[model samples]
Target: MSRALFRSSLPELGSFSAARLRPTAAVLPFSWTTTTTRSFNSTAPIVEPVSSNNAPNPTASQVRPLALKKSHPAAPPSPIADSVKNLLPFLAAQPGHYITVHIHGFPYLVQEGDQIRLPFRMPGVLPGDVLRLNRASVIGSRDYTMKGSPHIDERVFECRATVLGVESEPLRIKIKKKRRQRRKRQAKSKHRYTILRVSELNIKNLEEAAAE
Candidate 1:
């Protein structure tokens, strides 16, 4: 009886599997077929024609005139005074001279071979570098002196300084504290300065300055 029931179920299962394996045709709407055919047949993109009335005109832009600038004449250069030209030669002939040279607006009275410690460190200078001192207030020897109104012309005198090395100050410690706080802090600072020596100083002759 169990074998007869199993044989009857096998025929129903075979019929269901044959129905699933058979292919079925799918039907689509007329509008869907038309849209797909149009997309495949189109080879170029569609562009609408632009009307000439809405286009910008090249001649419609107005040309503006440039403004005229005013012209001015330059003032004449001032010539050196006759008295200074006459006195320069007498001052240059004397020996054993001292110059009041100005560096960074501060005046330093220095002679040849005098070592100077500048207040600030000089940049781009190394040991044995020679620097020319141009600004001077007074240039004098044992007999004659040539003093400028404010500052003597740098071309009249020549002064050169050699860089020796940099000198640094000792480290300073300052104690900082609050009124009610137990914690205290110490601030330390050290400053470095450049050292220079006046190597050569001379007053240029009138003929020499004119030739240069």
Candidate 2:
């Protein structure tokens, strides 16, 4: 193709100075949104938050011992009733008497010279020590029986026992083991008993009981 023919065939553009550019409608600058905050006064006081876990706790060793409770005092003695005073001589006249004595709230139907093995060992007593029994519920002979309301008076009868010694049971060993375990636990237990023998048991006459 010729240069004149190519120039005549091409599209024409106007001068560059008269070109329409969007200069008045400019793009706004990018910005983040602002939030309003309240300001506090400088003279106001600040409160600290309290937590329960931050408080100090007391240990077991620093704890104080508890006070022991006071025991109830014993009751005062009373005189014998008139009905018992009248019939007491008849019960005391009989021979071969048997008494149901109580020691530590336990009943023992015993006669003179009978031996007793207490289930638990008695404390504060050694062999050959004598103990006077003052509590009894029933006292009877072969022909007559005398029953008391809860307990007979100590002035009515005299019973004594001599501590023999302490007897111990054989040691018992128990083995405990778990299945497929190499370690085993062994527990051993042995118990002791106190021996006592009744030495004297006598009933008081009417004059003797009244004088006491």
C-alpha lDDT of all candidate models, in order: 0.84, 0.80
Worst 10 residues of 2 by lDDT: 30-39
Candidate 2 structure lDDT: 0.80
Tens-digit per-residue lDDT, 1-212, candidate 2: 69987776554333333344434433433232112222333346779765544424433344322332224335566755775777677778888889999888889999999998888889999999999989999999987677889998899999999999999999999999999999999999899999999999999997898799
Q: Identify the candidate with maximal lDDT.
A: 1
Clashing residue pairs in candidate 2 are none
Q: On residues 1-212, what C-alpha lDDT tens digit does candidate 1 reach at each position?
A: 99999999998999999987876544437678889899988868689765554424322353222232224224576755885688778878877889999888879998999998999989999999999998899999887777888998888889999999999999999999999999999999899999999999988899888877
Lowest summed lDDT window (length 10), candidate 1 = 63-72
